[model samples]
Target: MTPRELIDVADVPGGPPLRLFRRGGDFMIVLERNELMSTRMHGSEVALGTMACDRLAGRPAAHLLIGGYGMGFTLRAVLGRLGADARVTVVELVPGIIAWARGPMAAVTDGCLDDPRVTVEMGDVAATIGRATATFDAILLDVDNGPDGLTRPANNGLYGNQGLADARKALRPGGVLAVWSASSDPAFARQLQRAGFAVETVRVRARENGKGAMHVIWFATKR
Candidate 1:
């Protein structure tokens, strides 16, 4: 077996530091004992982007907001599907994650951050969402493990009732709010309904080849 090599550590405000690891060609971003993301298992993340874009099929010049640029999988998937007129804004809290993308993991990043259609914001995604109103066609969130904020306790607010309201307010009419989770949460799905969204929960495989652990994604369209 190839040994895992320690790459770098990134500090997260209001949360524990994240560690990057490399094993041969694969890269992993881990938080304490839990692996937050990996280059090896990004199918669900890609689906988060592609599936959301599918819901917005007729909008060629759509504007989208992405929370957390994990391995750039979701962003790349979105870039592949959207037209040149489309716009994507990505908000990431940890600086080192971007550094690693431009630095050691450049190949995996595939220069997605430098795409002309994309904008990189260095801050909490919640702030960005709060500042916008009927601005985006879609908002995709893959920040924490599920909705409970495994990375940062403050992130928990992004899944709370107020957060759902803010997200709804930030999107254009019929815009989608796509959330990726490691597992399903019935309560959260119901909360989406209560927040006045037409929700659809999907189970997707972690690996691109249709194998590996099953992950959950919720597509909640604004009413």
Candidate 2:
């Protein structure tokens, strides 16, 4: 197999670093120091993000925080589901990934950045969450592959007991924290429990083509 080429890198506030690269036709974003986001066929990323958005039902002027901006799939999915009163804040660590989404992958995103309801927070999601005064109705985190934190060691904190507890504090009562993972993680689920969240795991197909690896999403609700 041919070696993957490094394209560009960017910095984030809290430490899960950002590095964007291309391998042949595939584009990848390395968070912390490893690949945190990638595009497989054409629409798997959007699909996974959509799975999280699908659970966001209601019309309470929802506020959402998306951790990663990989090709803007999750942002696009959220926009499709949200009403005009809803607001979405996308916190992306990598400037290059945002640039790539506006540049090479613009067609896929379909002007999501320019949408009036969307706000782009170009920093570590943890920083924004820690500082935000308002609580969100939903927090969809797809920044890392799973709870183990392969992209960056610091990301493990988000999946750990304290991190999950912080997330619960960030949300409004009964608000949901939807996390997408490359695989199922029982320990992370336990951590969510310890954080005082009602958690549910959903297994999903990885590829838009309907045939690929199986992925998991942990939907944890704050009560």
Candidate 3:
């Protein structure tokens, strides 16, 4: 068995610090004992971007707001589906996450961050959403384990009623809000409905080979 090697640690404001670990060739970003993300199991993360772009097929110049740049999996997936005219704004709360991308994880990053259509913002995604009004064609969120804010206590607002409402207001008519989760949450689906969105909950496998743990993604469209 290969031993896991610690690469570096990053501090998260209001939450626990994140640790980067490597075992063999695979990398993992762990929050305490809970592994937040891994390079090995990213099929669902890729799907989050691919499926959301599928919904916006007709729009060539769509502006997308992606929350959290976890290992750049979703960002790369989104960039693959979008055209030259399309724009993507990625907002990340933790500065070290970006540093890891450009530093130790550069090989895995594959120059996605340097893409012309992408804009990197170091800030809270909720604040970015609040500042906009019908500005985005889609909003992709993979900020926490799920909607209940396992990463940080403040993240709970992003999944609550007001946060959903704010998200609705931030999107253009018929825009999609894509959220990724490690597991399922039935109540959150209903909450999306109550927030006046047409919600679709999808289950996807963690690995690209279509074998691994199951994950959930909620694609909520503004009504």
Which pairs of residues have clashing backbones in candidate 1? none
Best of the two (2, 3) by lDDT: 3
How far is 10's C-alpha from truth in model 3 (Å)? Answer: 0.4
Candidate 2 pairs with clashing backbones:
17-32
Q: What tens digits encode model 2's per-residue C-alpha lDDT throughout 31-134?
A: 65555666764244566556656666674688988888777777887888888998998988767678878876677668999999999988778777776543
Which 10-residue span in candidate 2 carries the lowest summed lDDT? 40-49
Give me the displacement of residue 183 in model 2, in angstroms: 1.3
Task: Residues 84-118, candidate 3: write the lDDT tens digits.
Answer: 99999999999999999999999999999999999
True-structure RMSD, every candidate: 0.6, 2.9, 0.6
Give me the overall lDDT of model 2: 0.76
Residue 12 Cα positional deviation in candidate 2, in Å, after optimal superposition: 6.3
Task: Order the numbered candidates by lDDT, best leading.
Answer: 1, 3, 2
Q: Candidate 2 — which residues are off by over 4 angstroms?
A: 1-26, 30-36, 42-44
Extract clashing residue pairs from model 3.
Answer: none
Q: Candidate 2: deviation at residue 74, Å?
A: 1.1
What is candidate 3's local distance difference test score?
Answer: 0.95
